[model samples]
Target: MSEAIRIRVTSQHLAESSNPAQQKYAFAYHISIENCGREAVQLLNRYWLITDADGKKTEVRGAGVVGKQPVIAPDECYEYSSGAILDTPVGTMQGYYEMQSADGNTFQAPIPVFSLVVPNLIN
Candidate 1:
């Protein structure tokens, strides 16, 4: 039921939290997960594939987000903010969320690939 879910992402560079000289780049991403279906769904787990400008890739897998597995109601939305650290000034994140419907059916909601870039770094 891919059409039953919608995922949106926005990101910002945390300059204060990053040290370019030290090869540390920090970025914060805000996610909005909307349940467009008629049934409620619970987020079970998250899988992320982060790739930096240098072609370095890192994968992250965890239970829930922000320490909580939230149940989103029909036509409702759940939002959260989280950050990632990279070695380069630019990166991209894409993944999916494991979701369980009220009827015990499990499905994956895709997270669109979004950019993480430091301001003025990319032309």
Candidate 2:
């Protein structure tokens, strides 16, 4: 399938915000969404599937991201930073964005699976 939007993710372990003893692992992720098509699109909603090391899964569905429904023009990019807390030291997240094009067509833009791991957790 042709892609109209591309997503890139970068993750960081937040040591200062994590409590290993309590099984709380905090991670911050920066996401950049680029419109690769010829039309401008507005991100309407998001759906995420997060899985922890123990196979625990959590689903997050929300409207917009960081409180804004960003409209990205063709060849333009939108960036945001978000955080997630996991019970394990490592996990993975993947999802899709619901977008509406300027011409009124709606589509789903897939967000590639990315890892969320604490530094030095694995060799």
Runs off by more than 4 Å, candidate 1: none
Q: Using Cα atoms with residue i matched to residue i, what is each candidate's TM-score against the true structure?
A: 0.97, 0.97
Q: Which runs in model 2 stand beyond 4 Å of their true positions? A: none
lDDT assessment of candidate 1: 0.94
lDDT of 1 at 119: 94
lDDT by residue (tens digit), candidate 1, 2-103: 579999999999999999999999999999999999999999999999999999999999999999999999999999999999999889999999999999
lDDT of each: 0.94, 0.94
* lDDT (10s digit) by residue, model 2, range 19-80: 99999999999999999989899999999999999999999999999999999999999999
Question: For candidate 1, what is the total of clashing residue pairs?
Answer: 0
For all the candidates, what are their Cα RMSDs to the real structure? 0.8, 1.2
